[model samples]
Target: MRTSRTELLLGRTLLVVALVLTVLPLLSMLSAALQPADRNPTGLSWPSDPQWINFVTAFQVGHVWQLMGSSALIVLGVVPASLLFATLAGYALGGLRVRGGRAVLVFLVLGLTIPFEALIIPLYYQAQAMGTLNTQWAIVFPLIGLFMPFSVFWMRAHFVNVPVELSEAARVDGASIWQEFRRIQLPLATPALSALAILLFLWTWNQFLLPVVLVANPLDRTVAGALTFFQGQYYSSIPLLNAGALIIITPAIVVFLIFQRQFIKALLQGAVKG
Candidate 1:
């Protein structure tokens, strides 16, 4: 009983520490953003007079709405398509047991080790030859392809853990592989799919490097990518910069909040499934 109590106390203490560590920087940024835009604020000190209007001004000047739209467009394009392909590949490898699937899975896992940064140069030339540079496609295609390796691995993990009896039963009922995945395995894999969707959404929305490198037009780039251009123009206005940064992250926060229940469900489902 004493050991259990001690472990519980330690865990709770760690959780509190983590909560503070996560929240403290956000609070400091908020404090800094509330100060006058003209003066450079130091540390976490609150201003005598708060300039809440800084956010409003920053939104207009930073083109937050347009940035949001651009990001939304990219996310919609990337997430659904990536999920579909990853799901198909994962099912083939994990559920169907395709010929040479193990070797292919090894290569896909290896792809994960090859950092995105290394491929940027080759991708740049490829996009140029394809005439996609300076366009949203430049950002969209690379993100989808780059994301595949991990996404496939993730889905494969879920499908592998699924009971083989489920597929065997479906096969006995004269169901094709397609029907088995569509009707039986797919429904059971909801938690995995939902969790993967949220992750892809976040990664696609927060994508900065690919957009910056591939899309020359700032307006065509994601909000996070556009932040660099925004920073260049408003480097002197610290408050505006902080406000704009907060504005940029708001959509992601909203997304997480809206889907938080599904996210948690996925985690719990995984625990039980495993």
Candidate 2:
């Protein structure tokens, strides 16, 4: 059915309203970050003289470069590892019928329900006992496990929708399971995996609690985790704090901007089946 003029106008108006709601706060924060670090600016108004050096001041005082390095290392470790494991597990559960597969899927569903807050204390003690406390591994290891539920679910959703004929064709050609996965299914699953990687990278980069509890040094913390300590020290400095916040989130924004097309494609890929 063709949409009426009134419906189109209403939809556009709603979208514009939603866009303004989302962009306004970001503009306000960027505005605030341009003010002098020592001066406290209130509300969302343009600064008389933008202090570009506020970013430099925040970068220096917050050790943002070091925190960024730490976050990069963590993202490198977490995203690839999580993607690899989740892909294999998703293939097993979604593409193949294995013994006890239902039970395993149920367990993962349960894992998703368990709140991170409830597990933090136990994870802390476990890290302490394993002597991994205060190390980057402390953060990297738990993140992989915590990410498994959602990652597996995402890949499995893609895998389940894949036609069985593709797998059968590979098998008829005398291809082993690994060979089939490597040569056939994986190529078709690229969009889904790319989307998953983007989500995993953002989650790992923004992880705050694990680094805070498990890692002791501010330098060792992820950028978002380090933000807590930075805030405590510079609570009085609004400009620097806002600048630091922007620096920490910039990577995630950039990644989404770059991969947004793939991300949208992945979401829409499964929307229709022939």
TM-score of each: 0.94, 0.94
Q: Please provide, for model 1 over 48-146, each residue's C-alpha lDDT reduced to its tens digit, 9 standing for 90 to 100.
A: 899999999888887778888999999999999999999999988988889999999999989999978999999999999999998898888989999
lDDT of 2 at 268: 98
After superposition, the stretches of candidate 2 with alpha carbons farther than 4 Å from their true spots are 1-7, 229-233
Question: Would you list the C-alpha lDDT of every candidate in the order shown?
Answer: 0.87, 0.90
Q: What range of 10 consecutive residues in model 2 has the weakest lDDT sum?
A: 225-234
Number of the predicted model whose lDDT against the real structure is largest: 2
